[model samples]
Target: MKILNPAMRIIFLLSVLAFGIQACTNNAKEETSLKMLQNKVDSLNLFVQKMKPGLGELMTNIQLHHEKLWFAGTGLNWKLADFEIGEIKETVDQAKEIETDRPETKSLTMLSEPINAINHDIENQDINQFKKDYGILTQTCNTCHTANHFEFNVITIPSAPTVSDQDFKTLQVR
Candidate 1:
């Protein structure tokens, strides 16, 4: 093998050293970028954990909506009843999504039938059927609670409107 001249050897060594330095610099940059990305992901996870509502809070919202739904149906306000049912369904869906770890969430499926029944009654504008279906919905709620060992939290047909500011009756327009 032909021996490399001293100057050639120096140039070759310098080239290898330069390439090694560049590779190390790129590796360090990649590691820094990865750490920053991981930190961003951790921050988002923490924010979500803080913002997530508890199962009890979600159930309380459902209870309020349930009371409103009763008044709406009893007052023959089909539109309002429909809206209240929709809100209940939305809240139930949110509970299912956010409280996946809770066993009670699994029982939420039992509500779907009663909710759909009430919706059908509302669509038909059948006040009698709506009242009957509303009882069913309330009973279903109590059933779920009882099954979940929350029997003390009994749900019943509301005797009076909880909110005084809002009217359950449909507005009559001239």
Candidate 2:
């Protein structure tokens, strides 16, 4: 068996000690980086939690869009009707995402059929069909409200434009 001399033994021990120190330094750096990433994630989560809208707020937006849709359809403004329906669908989608914990969110699926029918009526540009489909949509909204124990919030066909500033009628280009 060959024995390492004194100088070689000291060199080997110092090399091992240096390697150990470098490994510890690398571990410390990794831990700091992980903690920084965790802090960023926590901050983003808090921001999103604060920005989330309540279910009632989303429903109120839907209600406004529903009224505007009625006016647009009755005025034979298919484009505007389509836009309103899109807005309603968007708000409903947002509700589904942000209000996942709410039981009422589960009833939102009931609106899909009626909404699709309304979109079909809009595409055909048939005011009569639009009115009928609009009625069905309103009824569906009320049905959802009833199922969610919010029966008092009944939705009905709008008798007049909710907003007077904007004309529901389509402007013809002369």
Candidate 3:
């Protein structure tokens, strides 16, 4: 008969625990990467909204994730319906249902859906109407916030940071 002694069993359990820990670590890393991409999206939107300019470099950075995020957002190579729209609706609906200190405005969610639509357009290389779409999304953010009593906390399109160190430019090999 095969048997695992206490010491062997403990070692085996520890190995499983180690693997669990590694998986959690990996998830955290991936989450951070996703947030970085979102932040860049926010930053670029701000720049565009304010007419601050400098999109070439920012776009180059956005392009770096062309495959990783911009495309994989759908979790598929090609699709008719915009996948990011589904994400926007899901997130906004969930956010609205949650009981927070303030009622849910879905300002950020509203604000980003149009932007994501633009991103979808960009990914398809259909550059004709992205800017108009983005403007509408930015307006949605402000309008939602004001209507929901979060006027004091109106979230604008994020711009070049005075505090954050995350770079949006595509990485360079040095």
Candidate 4:
């Protein structure tokens, strides 16, 4: 049997060690690049999901809530108005949550004060005050539309019933 000398054995061991280390280095580089690409794809998928509602559906929601608020407040149904204002605020908050990067999203934040005013009127059960504050709220909506280049989408003090299924009259005495 032939046996390697000490110096040759040392060289053989070092070569094998170096080959193993190079293989590990290549594997690490490939894994890191693959992970980076996967992370980007995941982030993009999340963003697309957030944008799924599109602008038309969002605008429709705001318009529907506005119409319901109008009917409730005008009918002197303060409780219904209160419920609707909460829905409106929550819908607006959802808009901000999902579309934080949009300029129109910032404009929606302008409704906070008007919403608060409407809330106060509802709490007081002051029909006249509610009507006045609701006008301001409509104005804010129009202002937001104008600022966002949606001036064509003018919102007004709703006078006619858009939702016929629900009674806006106060059914129960508070």
**Candidate number of the best lDDT:** 1
TM-score of 2: 0.90
Question: Distance (Å) between predicted and true CA of 146, model 1?
Answer: 1.1
* Off by more than 4 A, model 1: 1-4, 172-174
lDDT to native, each model:
0.91, 0.88, 0.51, 0.85
| Tens-place lDDT digits, model 3, residues 1-174 | 149988899999999999999999999999999999999999997775566323233323322333233323222332322443445445454444442333453343554667567667656745345445645654675586578665774444333333234333222311
What's each prediction's TM-score? 0.91, 0.90, 0.35, 0.77
Worst 10-residue lDDT window, candidate 1: 165-174
Candidate number that wins on lDDT, 2 or 3: 2
> Per TM-score, what order, best first?
1, 2, 4, 3
Clashing pairs in 3: none
- Give the clashing pairs for model 2: none
What is the overall TM-score of model 4 with all chains considered together?
A: 0.77
Local accuracy of candidate 4 as per-residue lDDT tens digits, 93-136 = 88887776676787677999999999999999888888888889
After aligning candidate 3 to the native by TM-score, how far in Å is the CA of 35 from where it should be? 44
Instruction: List model 1 lDDT by residue over 1-174, tens digit each.
Output: 149998899999999999999999999999999999999999999999888999999999999999999888877878888999999999999999889889889889999999999999999989888888888999998898888899999999999988899889876621
Where is the poorest 10-residue window by lDDT in model 2? 165-174
Which candidate do you rate higher for lDDT, 1 or 3? 1
- Model 3: how far residue 149 lies from native, Å: 2.4
lDDT of 2 by residue, 1-174 (tens): 149888899998999999999999999999999999999999999998888888888988999999999888877878899999999999998898888889788778888999999899999998888888888888898888887788998989888877889888877621
Provide the clash count, candidate 1: 0
